[model samples]
Target: MQKSIAVVFDSAGTLLHMYRVAKDMSSGDLLTGVESTDLVARRKGRALIVLHTEPSVILAVDRNMRVIDFIDGHDIAIDISCASVPFSVEEAYDIIKDSDIRVDDILQVVGVVRKHCPEIFYVAAGIIVDRNDHSVPYVLSTGGRLFHDSKETVDRLKGLGVSVFIASGDSRRNLKQLAECMGISMERVYDIATTREKARIILELKDTYDKVLMVGDGMNDILALRAADVGIVTLQQGDHRPEKLEMSADVVIRDIREVLGIVESL
Candidate 1:
């Protein structure tokens, strides 16, 4: 059997449920919610139900409220697509501020957003706050029902002398929080800036670890998944359909716990 040293897992969709947080206007508080097909925002106490539409638009519905407001996906995408600084919120803001896009155009977009999404607000604030902090706020939605199982798997892997690390697109701070939740140390979390960077981390670790296993469930994870010795694609909640060439994983599983079994088989 091949000896394995480290196992890398993606944060969202692999260990945590994919959801966004937004400010509820009625209560003036933040709420975590999943995107839904219905055009209504169902709120159970402080929880929320986000209405999702494609071409990639999202509407935040509060407390079972109907159609609070809808944001145009095109408007949101314009800023994101035009952003040259993919990792730096400050750089992204500088580009936006210096751009020729009129202030009116920006306001028009904001006017349509009924719920103030914390992720967007924090990024905007991060640009104005200290750029060194890397303070992109995230809503660490409650872990999925199987999250405890995932944590157990991590514990088991660690007990077997496997080094477990998180290589995720999420910020360092967010990854640290997740690591703490799973009882992993912050040093093991790798805050990923790009898909290629994720792969690079795996390559660098390979220098010492030799046998590395990467478990992921999104298109963003394809590169790192391919770079690892054994890439396992998880079919968990919030998993996106892997693009044609991006599905480069060596194995596929329905549960995260299965990753341990595959590693044991190796």
Candidate 2:
């Protein structure tokens, strides 16, 4: 039998909202460990550096920095943990040496991160990085929770014979857990950790499905929405920056259940 329209959903905002963890989400300036005074000096010379560090687990910043790729410090390594990669002291310095990023650029990226992660906190200006190569930052990131009845919505979509896929900036482990909880096939999930990757995945899905619908609620999902045949923005009351999403998506939905109706009509 011919397949119904395929739907791709962004994991963080579209499938689940931000569920608080131990503390509210916050970010702060990157600090230097001993002998690493040069790092802070470099920032002072060029730009103010801000970072979102979740101790022992992750360090994140906006993607525009391009610092994630060049750094190869002993304690620091870059990996696809989020849209932005985390770093340790040496790795962060590696990026600075290779890229020579300016202060204005760092400010711009920090602003974008602040806008998106409102729970973001700016750590103390002079937080010490210390000589400990494995020193973890004090800040911690929050978690995500599925929208009310989200699993039911996926089940309903499958009931209607629609092919459902997940494209998200979240870690593979998180997405895998979500897939298992919702009974979604692991093969159908894509760890699209960047905006460009999300759009690329949508295009790839388009090749297999006659029609593709992309649904999301964050700025990162904008490009993918435009790439799909139909883009739906799921709006929740009191949510941040709904207007931006409304403008980006082809259709604005107030409820996750609305997606089922939208698909049926298509």
Candidate 3:
């Protein structure tokens, strides 16, 4: 019998379900819920969904491993189609690293969020400072990360003899940290990878594997998802509809745990 091989995961959604689940999926509803709360993050409350689209388009860790603000969000957006920065990382990073958004604002929002579901504070805040004037407001960047079963999940797949690979837009240093934390080998990971590269890599493994599966949540993972024998998608929103991804996916889920069930049968 031939062994089955799977080219797995697009990251930030499939394996890592970003935007922790929330009862209220809108900005106004999230803020209002927080305003009614007094406590900080609680495991027994509703989750807070992401307010923005992309996370990496915001602050990037420099070659020095320092978190540096990338583009001017005020000029562009944290959306998938990102653009150039008009300001310097030095000037923009200071404002966000030293935020005045009031603990009350965050506490209220996070509190209300926790009241409905379990939430994780993966990132504090991302902002930018003015270039010409230091005191002026620059922009608010985006964020990402998931509250997940980090180590166990990967081990489960590895035990099944899957040659799992991670190709992400994140830096090599960051991916290495995550892979180590997950007990996966850094030698098996690829960082700063583009969408086409993801697809190409999967096809390259086609000669070895009887079957391959690709799972993702972002638009960037579309091509790679389609290239696989099976594809899965994890995001569902009105504006951020998982349509393109759904078309690419053989399986679709609002949750990530559901994937194990679908993949094991294959």
Clashes of each: 4, 11, 9
Q: What tens-digit string does per-residue lDDT give for candidate 2 at 1-266? A: 56558998887657776532111112444321211112222222211122332322223433343433313222333333222223344443443444433223334333444445554322111122212332222212234567777889999999988899998755555678789988889899986346677888989888888889998876667778899999998875235544665787888988888999889877
Give the better candidate number (1 or 2) by lDDT: 2
Q: Taking the tens digit of each residue's C-alpha lDDT, what string does model 1 give over 103-148?
A: 2322222333323332321111011111233221111122222355
| Ranking of all candidate structures by their lDDT, best first | 2, 1, 3
The TM-score measured for candidate 2 stands at 0.60
Residue 158 in model 2: shift from native, Å? 0.6
Worst 10 residues of 3 by lDDT: 33-42
Clashing pairs in 3: 34-108, 45-114, 45-115, 45-116, 45-117, 46-115, 46-116, 46-117, 92-129
Whole-model lDDT values for every prediction = 0.51, 0.56, 0.47
Regions of model 2 farther than 4 Å from truth: 1-3, 20-140
Instruction: Report the backbone clash tally of model 2.
Output: 11
Candidate achieving higher lDDT, 1 or 3: 1
Each model's TM-score, in the order given? 0.58, 0.60, 0.55
Candidate number of the best lDDT:
2
